[model samples]
Target: MLHIFCPHCGELRSEEEFHASGQAHIARPLDPAACSDEEWGTYMFYRDNPRGIHHELWDHVAGCRQYFNVTRNTVTYEILETYKIGEKPQVTADGKQTNAPSTVKGQGEKV
Candidate 1:
């Protein structure tokens, strides 16, 4: 029942319209042959589930069929921003202002 914002469509939609692909912004090993098992395991299992704000990758399964980032409040379920694949997350150019994206209505409660 979560509402996910589609960066491509600029619409908030039900969670059903989206699919969690996995962790986003993962840096792949530049030299896989040089990596140890421990290093690979660390990359695979470690996650930063911070309490206040978090960035995640989500796919607009039913909408744009594209993947985007979402900045949401973990505790309040408030989405701070939803932006295109490579664009900034609604941040000011000077990086001083912080504006959370507004929620669109008629969507389910979760997402």
Candidate 2:
């Protein structure tokens, strides 16, 4: 079983204590009531299922009962990092720290 570190609880807990909610970073529509059925449906149901690094929202149901973000590998099922809702991940999809200098020159913007 994969041991997941809960950012809120500050302890490593078993995976059974949590539940994978879905794809993270889903932005709610600016005006939900103004959306058409098709638009609303797409916003509510559409999610990306990538083969590589995937960011997910998880709920610590059996622990602190708080929700957090998890960056994990889809194929290897490796939990890269867990963080609070408002915090940016230290690592990126290419397995590099966000603050690290890039190889390409003049492209130092956050992706």
TM-score to true structure, per model = 0.72, 0.84
lDDT per prediction?
0.66, 0.79
RMSD of each: 5.4, 8.0
List candidate 1 segments past 4 Å from native.
Answer: 90-111
Q: lDDT tens string, model 1, 20-84?
A: 76555678889977889999888878877777666677888888799887766668776666666
After superposing candidate 2 on the true structure, give the runs of residues whose Cα lies further than 4 Å from its correct spot.
Answer: 100-111
For candidate 1, give the lDDT. Answer: 0.66
- Candidate 2 lDDT for residue 69: 87
Screening candidate 1 with a backbone cut-off below 3 angstroms (N, C-alpha, C), the clashing residue pairs are 1-110, 2-110, 2-111, 3-110
Worst 10 residues of 2 by lDDT: 102-111
